[model samples]
Target: MSKHSVVIFVSQRNSLRSILAQACLAHLGSGRFLALSCGWPGMLADAIHPAAIGALNSASMPIPNHRPRDWNDLARPSAARAEFVITLDETTSSFQPRWPGQPDSALWAFPDVAAAGDPEKVAHLAIQMLYALRRRLELFVSLPLQGTDRAAIRSDLRDLAHMR
Candidate 1:
């Protein structure tokens, strides 16, 4: 099996969706993939969202102790390398950073759960995003990365991002 690395980015506030995706992918990939997350430059929280932790815990997935990282944090040589870079938000032009390699990239923008409601509602949205992303990550880890099917893989990634 070809092991791949991925970076998940959300334009701002790595505290929520991006961190959730990073933790979920780490478990969902089951060693076939390595994942990390980063956000736009800004004051970062020391802890991730309580609802993010809750969703992962409720699903029995390992809750990662993630500190919100900025774009520069991801550019460090010691940072995990990425073969794929998935943006969890649409404002890529606003904060995209150069990585060591030109990783295949895609945007998977889900509703900003933090912007939409109370803590309870945010937790619900987190689970919803988790369920959707889990399916995609499963498929991603199963793909033949060594083969010349990159176009198909990219297409599949885009299609998966649009799932409800």
Candidate 2:
């Protein structure tokens, strides 16, 4: 049996954070699990987000062909059932996906690093987002199936999203 299949949700696929998480998880996660990113049909067809690509390039984790996530990708016949659904968008606070089984869903919003006017500013934000998502994912993967650890992980993940 597979550990878990997770799908990540975001607003647009033209930016850094979601794409970075998709790229990172795809690289770091190996084939033990599956990771995918989905955004609304609001992404620009510019290959990849430039700053995001640059940041990944700097980290030596380049994903050159990341496009927007479509309904076909989300509701696919060959797609494995997702064990967890995580949303990583600021505008997705009320965003509820229509997953088939309605698996355990959570959100972990981070600032959009790609929108900063200054390159340095954007770079800093991207670094922050990368680390934040990495930490959250670490916490996510370490969550126990049952017991106090599971409760703690659930609470922390909610706090990461709802602690506004």
Over 66-92, each residue of candidate 1 has an lDDT whose tens digit, in order, gives 588787877777777677778887765
- Any runs in candidate 2 off by more than 4 Å, and if so which? 1-4, 43-45, 76-78, 145-156, 159-164
Q: Write the per-residue lDDT of candidate 2 for residues 64-83, one digit (tens) a residue.
A: 36566643467465666665
Instruction: Give the poorly placed runs of model 1, Cα more than 4 Å off.
Output: none
Q: Rate the local accuracy (lDDT) of all candidates.
A: 0.74, 0.62
The top-ranked prediction according to TM-score is 1
lDDT for 55 in candidate 2 is 72
User: How far in Å is the alpha carbon of 48 misplaced in model 2?
Assistant: 1.7
Model 1: per-residue Cα lDDT at residue 3? 51
Check candidate 2 and list the clashing pairs.
none
Query: Could you estimate the TM-score for every candidate?
Result: 0.87, 0.75
